[model samples]
Target: MKLKTLVGTFALAALPASMSFAWADAAPEMTDAERAQAKQIYFERCAGCHGVLRKGATGKNLEPHWTKTLQDGNKVEGGTLKLGTNRLERIIAYGTDGGMVNYDDILSEKEINLMARYIQQTPDAPPEFSLKDMRDSWKLIVPKDKRPTRQMNKINLQNVFAVTLRDAGKLALIDGDTHKIWKVLDTGYAVHISRLSASGRYVYTVGRDGLTTIIDMWFEEPTTVASVRLGSDARSVDVSKFKGYEDKYLIGGTYWPPQYSIMDGETLEPIKIVSTRGQTVDGEYHPEPRVASIVASMTKPEWVVNVKETGQILLVDYTDLKNLKTTTIESAKFLHDGGWDGSKRYFMVAANASNKVAAVDTKTGKLAALVDTAKIPHPGRGANFIHPQYGPVWATGHLGDAVVSLISTPSEEAKYAKYKGNNWKVVQELKMPGAGNLFVKTHPKSTHFWADAPMNPEREVAESVYVFDMGDLDKAPVQLNVAKDSGLPETTAVRRAVQPEYNLAGDEVWISLWGGKTDQSAIVIYDDKTLKLKKVITDPAVVTPTGKFNVFNTMHDVY
Candidate 1:
């Protein structure tokens, strides 16, 4: 049977029970406050997959439909369908093979139990957010007229890296040239991704809590000038990169409310809100088709907005916001994160749950190709480089498979017309030591490819990063012990290595040693030439740094 059919059947079987099951009698009950806390936790942690409405897309359906009590008062139990509280708790604690990370290390036992119970109850529909709500919550702390006309500091804006200190609810601005932390500014909880304006003057950060902050780098202190709340939960944010609309507008994608919000780029005054709830490419009406990623087209005055559940890529014309025009291209389901190809004309996004990478030709506004890939391809702005044999290829690391898939992309350049036959094909699959990888990175000037397996539950794999030589694709990756190389004392907890980012010159690569909230986390730097550890940045304030984006690379979409 197809996965979608299986999912539908599973969801239908889990409908809420009219009478309480026998397991509820033995299960520990929660107070009103605890229940509320559990709901919040679910929104922050589980909503991205299971969805705000508990209708599964990338993740399994978590509604109470699976835990309904039978006429005999027994909980639902059948082949591969176990809805008991104990089974639910174990799944939450240990995670499944479907790319869900183990929460045992991230959440407490009590919280896990609460979440297990929370899913058994009927799902709640979050309050809808409108343009008025966004406008009311918008705050312009510093007007554009009051902002500096010229660069106020000597810091090289291109070399500055915006690092997300996830658990700390802060963004650490680090000088990539000097490898030093410049400033740590407060932001929303677990800022998803930091985006740079077209001119590279402003840094925009949207958090999981739906808070978006616009930071002006021209300020002497590099502080946030404007802020607004998109909704309750958001993941992606991007500014207009087209010539006419350079930094004129900003767009944010929210997981909850299933909507996207557009605001003034300078002041963050929300102008419009569009709901993504509609029929998916599969011809099914999905209620929770969250906007996953939005990338501005460099060749056209448009934004490629990827709707996660619907598997529809909407090329939204930003030329006229009042009367917006969109061209929809159907692809695979669960479109998450992606990046531009080497030519920047083709935008490739990972439809992770479907195990496919959908490449769209932004210049033509059409679906370029849909290439099959390994399971759960979670590429955070996937790596792009010229393959030795193939003309150009994009790299994506997988979470459910032990391989890094390199796909050949078509190029319009006249110099390389012979390799056009390999376009939109999986040319190679580099074997990694293990699965569970979130990011794969390569700089234009670097000959090495870096990938981190932080999502892997195994300590050895999670604590290490693999580096592959671009000169030879057949050789195995050199495993670097990132946690041990951090020069910090070993702990029982796994300090996962993640997010390899390059400096402006691509001479050095930085990896984050993500430890527990209370433990000391460090950003370990390595010399790209020698593949040797250079420096380990650890401080009290650098807590749980996950993703570090270089200003020059991010602004230009180098990767």
Candidate 2:
């Protein structure tokens, strides 16, 4: 509410220094229920007049307002029309044209008011990128010096910022640098997957209920700036390569009535909706490529989508959103995971829950190598959960338990600059052998890393976490000797832990342990180098909170 008065000045300052424009008005925020109701209004009364997808058959893209300037330049082409905030509101409140019926009397003023604000507001901004940009390359090693901020929170600098989908449809912001919580904002939906805008100004979350909410993390005071309704039953969202394109157009999939929708992130306007060949549940996908998981190549900035059910990896030219091309890979049981390995040269896939991590050359889409990562029998947890992480090497989790099936790639270039060149090797398999999920975080400098092998919950117990190094072939799993139980004695090794992430500073590793399958969970932090315990905090709100439990909430992943 206070933002309204200050937003005008903020907008003025945000204008590109090169451009000169008149004063603009600040938009209002919509209530959660109002946003939910707007979709119903869209389908019932509005779809016929404006194109259902909102790309101006009669109306505009609805998201991005259709009047936003093209990425190529500051000009508006194709006779695209623009509407002022008041004008757009009046049109919705009253009516337009002969066929478009007036909603003034039919719809309540409250409903009409929300749609007005929705049409006028720009898409939410992405979270700011804190890393310094180096043209060639960068590494994410842990930083030295351990200290808390003025707020008594740890200050970490190298951790990857991650958004966890709380069971209640809210999103919490955790500072990866300090292992301290920055803020937690209600997303207004049951969030599943999320992606930040390229500019790092907005954080977007797409939920299972088919709602996408964008938060303005760029501000010191994070807020859910906008909420857009995507339709029902949406799953995952991949950010389009085009940065700041109407607040990050997301390519997402749905469960029932199987289909994919490319939506304007800012306005939640459906740009193009396509039907898939098979329902995602059946795994009987057809050639109709609906987006399963979309991500842009860090190297070339091309948009890549993994058609999960079909095992299809579709690479689309970034220049033209329509210029899509596809190449199918062997069934990995999941299209949601796997992609060009760290090098961005070969496509990698987890083969049918097997320990075999397969790779294919992207150019030919043919199997190049089936790197056997330890001869362990495949644990049947359904292929859906057997996902891999992208690093200089490919790391996969086995459903069976504690064995982290790792596949190494040669770090040799004709001329490797910073790190030493090495040969292709099966650096040693560190075995903690058990029935737990595997989460891996790579160290910035060395080939050393850590994996969260859950043991139990509460009291005091000895749980083993592997801090092994995978150097050149001759070397085996060199466990980075850490002072076991050196710090945070309250953290018993018996509890189950979920996602363990490194702080931006790479100095500490934060682990979120399930409160013994109860309401008592703990957030533990480990010194990256010494493996000494830094802190252990408890949380009873492992899932949701009423009021008292809110204070106990620690994060799962660092931002």
Candidate 3:
């Protein structure tokens, strides 16, 4: 049992029974450098939704048996929980209608009472990365017949951009027709999503520290030919975009062993790991159900996969990964991130703690609607558009509502058959001047739709970026400060503009000014027909720049 002592014995079996005599009777109210600065602010903002063994998928279970459970059944000698510490510091300074974000404008009240007494202490356990520790952290490094088969780089693999240099574990690869920076590399750690390979000549990425990599933009400088590691946290990755499997299998998912893996799209190897725990689609029993947002179904070689704490979507079937059928379906509950509707046959997603969105269809693999949205929502790949008067909608954006809803998607043409009686319904909400939001984009030859609150904590709506007007969806959007159009220099901390994308000639949009990691970040771009600011892209290796994508709209996932 030495896979680093079996991941430190599964993080000490995720501590519970008197976690060290309740942290030795709450160790003198915090002093070992304030519990090491509250475990580095719970590993940079609460271990990505209450985890690192606090065992809750998409947030909530701060263990110590539910954050110290105490309506007075006596506990709190450091195992603090009768929901106290002023109701978990007012749910970490006002934020939690589930999509949890109001760190009272980014933590302070002494870092939200030191992360509400650091999740009521007792939660360290972080080591189990098995699958022979991801095949002993695999690495190939340039092997598909020593790479470069064709385009040995004149760079413009459909306007290359894949930026996510998040917390500098790196990815950069810029140059969307020379907005510059073209290659940063070294990944895995906050890389979250990049995924291209439907013959965009490989990009892949996927990291919240589960690594993944791949790269090879027909080399001669694009590099990193292969890499692996899909456990110990991860976000999502795709690849096998059907049509005789273009990149031939890749998958990924993970947020800590709630499994997904499936490799070898071009030698990252590990072929199959599955396990998205059990029960949930509300049938209960979910021991961290996660495998959130996977996609890859351009009309089925199958992979829809969602699952966040078991709202169960699955579909899977990679044409027999040694006989693997799948097809689960059930919807709603924390699912997270979505897209594909201007008829890529449905597929929606965001169950964001159940404010619901769910969709599916993928050409009738079923569960096609769920709908009802607003609070939380957070649709990272959402925005489908064609709606001057609601004739094929699909939009999302919310972290606890302020509007942008949209919906309506279902059609058999005939000029959208009078809006098909508002198909999956909700038609229009739009509003937004607030609410946290995480991506909403749009561009099928544009008319403007973009969203992005960068998880709003307000510093002028998280450094602004709204822009509606698909010929006026009842007006009112054009916000745009994008950190004052990224001319950068306004820090009261929130330098977050975040992901807009669109360029394979949608005449520019780009965005990402996400600052911090020695802040200076920039990507801005704009000008999608006079929405203005066309290019700011500051450098010093444009460090913390989150999500950019666009290798021809992420090899045609298009949102």
Top-scoring candidate (TM-score): 1
Better of 1 and 2 by TM-score: 1
Cα TM-score per model: 0.93, 0.55, 0.32
Cα displacement (angstroms), candidate 2, residue 361, comes to 4.3
Which 10-residue window of candidate 1 scores lowest in summed lDDT?
Answer: 1-10
Sort the predicted structures by lDDT, highest score first.
1, 3, 2
Model 1 regions more than 4 Å off: 1-29, 67-81
The residue-by-residue lDDT of candidate 3 on 380-401, one tens digit each, is 8887868777788888888766
lDDT of 1 by residue, 54-124 (tens): 87866777766554322333444543334556667767776665566677777899888788777777788
What lDDT is obtained when candidate 2 is compared to the true structure?
0.43
TM-score-superior candidate, 2 or 3: 2
Q: Which prediction has the highest lDDT against the true structure?
A: 1
Candidate 1 RMSD to the real structure: 4.3
| Residue range with the least summed lDDT across 10 consecutive positions in model 2 | 545-554
> TM-score of predicted model 1?
0.93
